[model samples]
Target chain A: MGELRRYFDDIELGEEYESPGRTVTEADIVIFAGLSGDYNVLHTDAEIMKQSIFGERIAHGLLGLAIQAGLFTRATQAYATLAFVGLRWKFKGPIKIGDTIRLRAKVIGKKETPKPDRGLVTVQRSVLNQRGEVVQEGETDLMIERRPRP
Target chain B: MTGSYFEDVPLEHVEETPGLTITSAHVAIYLGLTRELAADGGAVPDVLPLCFTTGLGWRVPKPPLVVLAFMGLDWQVLRSVRVGDTIMSRSRVVTKRPMRDAGVVVEEREVVDQRGEVVQRGRFTYLVAKRTKETRA
Candidate 1:
């Protein structure tokens, strides 16, 4: 486990964190489909997708990104995160159902802001399947609060 | 150019949807799925609106793209989305590159609140299926 209540001052460039694994389930895909209203055959039609190249239903691309958000917060040092300001992401491969995925993130860049109480940090994030293949990868920018001065 | 198929989508075409109010129920389903609790419990989860950007694509009046796959996204959150805020998405087709049987369509997507302030903006690249001889028939 990492430090709790981590502040901007505590983040170090090049530091990495890995999250606990989570298996993508049928419910996850179905729930995401309803939530997003994206009933693409690739995700919803099993028989139809069975004839496609993938041969099975795959999770929504944004669903994986949403899961990555949860895994990031769970794995990283508990920062006083303020806002998720930016994301540069790519869908490199398909994430099929029953695939267990985890996040591997590294602090790639950091910058100070005009405000004294907060700063920005950029983390290179990767969502890897159980086989260690990177299904999705990107960089996310987060605004974090600074440590309080007594 | 009248249809929404890969080949039919014209560049610079803009599609906008009516406002959809963000309710606590939507946030609850999202939070239940992601299990991500905002650092400030009272605040909406940062990624909720980002996910909604894709969902809002369904609300457009124009026919949907015959998309084969989602390629990627380059997104920036310009402002926070509060509970009860009504947000709408505006997507403009920026580029279209044809492959063999499919095409890559890139669109500049924006989520604006009721006040018409941009809450989030992004570039979405989608792999769309072009109408072939079989599909055209």
Candidate 2:
């Protein structure tokens, strides 16, 4: 429906993709706090956060990671993904409300397994805010299904 | 209760949270908010468990640290989580490096299913504020 599936064989190192942007919202932070049980005053108490170093409430670092995953999935909707294996992520900066964030990802590494069914692909991802500053960056390893025989 | 100050936190400290069952509703809400569809067989999405680590950390009986900022994360996913799986977290402080006014604490955290099998594990680093006279009172 979106595009033909991009199997493991179809991928190449150095390939790059940019995802659509989504703005962070107040409700997003509030709901995440409730669901995650992270009622840190930095997120819940605006008056208190007004005096903190950041000077205002900020989105959870993990929230930005979760959104990046969704954005990447939507960008390459036809990826033949099997599972997410691991990641090394850094929270470089704060994500404030109403900041439109986009994901820029590049294929950095690939490896084949003993079996021919699937392979691993490593992607370097940067979550960039509206001003073009990278707020979060990471490398994620994914297992992708190989192209099926006809 | 107040959060754990940098100077007061002890190394090798450990804590665990109660089990939380992953329901369809929880999964749906997460997917809906992220604008993603449900996974095959209603399996939980990959990042959901990672997000749950924060909640699980909060649920532990021990007081949380006075985190000024989240520094980084190194995560590994070993098993898949499904809608019916009940998960818990076990976290241990692995390292502590004190700075001028703040300290960095690294926690080795693992998420386990009802059977106590490790579903995922990772090290989370946070920047915590130092305990001061103002904070003491």
Candidate 3:
């Protein structure tokens, strides 16, 4: 079992965590298409995409969001994450293949849930490309288990 | 396949999609793509990944070939979607605004499980190309 890094009470509001960068690849797009059943030509049809405004295939916006979630898992050792409650996000820019992206997340708010054993932690996240441009930004609310009391 | 032109879409038009069952294989494929390692020895959580929920939006019926670009997505998972649950999706055109050669279409999509419970909902915005009389001819 992975070690629990932080409990609900341990997270400090406004604290930020930066993730290691990973490059988006053609394989990532194809795999995501297969998994999501999103065969949108903009993502799969290079020839057609070249005629579009982007002039080339772009990663699915949701793929970028999913990558950010993966990066958050690696950056913050939140082994106690119970579930993702919700998210409010905007896709600011296109994530082209080969563009390396990373996440900068900060704790924005916290609240106790009706369930005494768990609480909600809201994190504001910004997904930046290698050029430091924000490709996506949003807030995610996560339910986390509280630390066990003696 | 010719997609619906911006002028063709009607506001508040709703479409329902066939039911899709979320199986362990589907979850495994998604988990593999994201590389989200489960801490409990690959035990699938009662709550699915948020992105997966968004992914289901793609399965919803959309205006044919008119999908030009994915502008944005705002979503919320209202309830847990457990593995082996059969879910169906429906979308309604909420708003449409014209741009240069295309227009943006905002759709409110909802995913309901077999039990008739709302599992997820979101607004998906897309840029759909405007069909000209020349193209229609």
Candidate 4:
């Protein structure tokens, strides 16, 4: 199981991995709401939702994204990693409760920055639901090692 | 349709001071509201992150897109947000740019607290539906 963890020396650009889908939960939403202080009526208010375009309360896009932490962390936390240089996200549809989200991640590219200790690795991420529809898609620039270390 | 972008939309002003104060009631209310609308169950605590992220999202200078999900979250509870901490938010649109991918655009939302300290920053991309629309907070 731990084989999923890839050290800096292991991964090559263009390498890809797929993970099983996970469901979003109510408890997850509630905790995030309080932590960030975002209370949009559409996200929080049912009545407002009914009066709005969606006609119902939908999962916040970020909730689907946050679930990625569990999926990606499990895959990479064993390896020493650094900062998330940057991420690009796209919201195609609502990720409602009870929906299953599958994570697809791939190492697209790597660049050697001026720093001798670290390099920037670009990884692509996709959150797809049960029907095989992609709800969220993006690429992230993450930190990796410049060379294998003892 | 060919149209102008966020760069063309232009920033009328950057509000540095805290525009609003957040309360526990606000948190609870938002949680309850989202839960009721979503028709999901369990206590409201689970939904706090959703509210906080959205609250922080709106407070972002001009969110090109909303939080769909977060890839990583490292929350520090140095100070528990209380009912009367007078939570204040100062949001600024940090960056905006076009993407190479077909049918998409991206922007960054950076939010700070009352002390002019950063609280949250999110880089999100959205599919543009309108040829042109007024983009503002």
Best by DockQ: 2
Q: How accurate locally, in lDDT, is each candidate?
A: 0.86, 0.88, 0.78, 0.52
Top candidate (lDDT): 2
Off by over 4 Å in 4: A1-5, A75-77, A146-150, B1-10, B17-54, B57-108, B111-137
Query: Model 3, range A101-136, lDDT digits (tens) per residue?
Result: 999999999899899898999999999999999999
Off by over 4 Å in 2: A1-3
Question: Per TM-score, what order, best first?
Answer: 2, 1, 3, 4
Q: Write the per-residue lDDT of candidate 3 for residues B34-119, one digit (tens) a residue.
A: 66665453445332443454455555555354676677777777777767778787778899999988899888878788998888
- lDDT per residue as tens, model 2, B20-129: 89888888878877866555756998789888878888876677788899999999999999999999998889999999999999999999999889999999999998
Docking class of 3: medium
The regions of model 3 sitting more than 4 angstroms off are A1-3, B39-62
Ranking by DockQ: 2, 1, 3, 4
- Tens-digit lDDT track of model 2 for A1-150: 424778899999999999999999999998888777788777787888888898999999988998898898777755778888999999999999999999999999999999799999999999999999999999999998998878
Instruction: List, residue by residue over B1-137, the lDDT tens digit for candidate 4.
Output: 22333334343244343345555555455543333221123222222332354455455444333322222322222222333333343333434444442123343444444565544455434443333343332
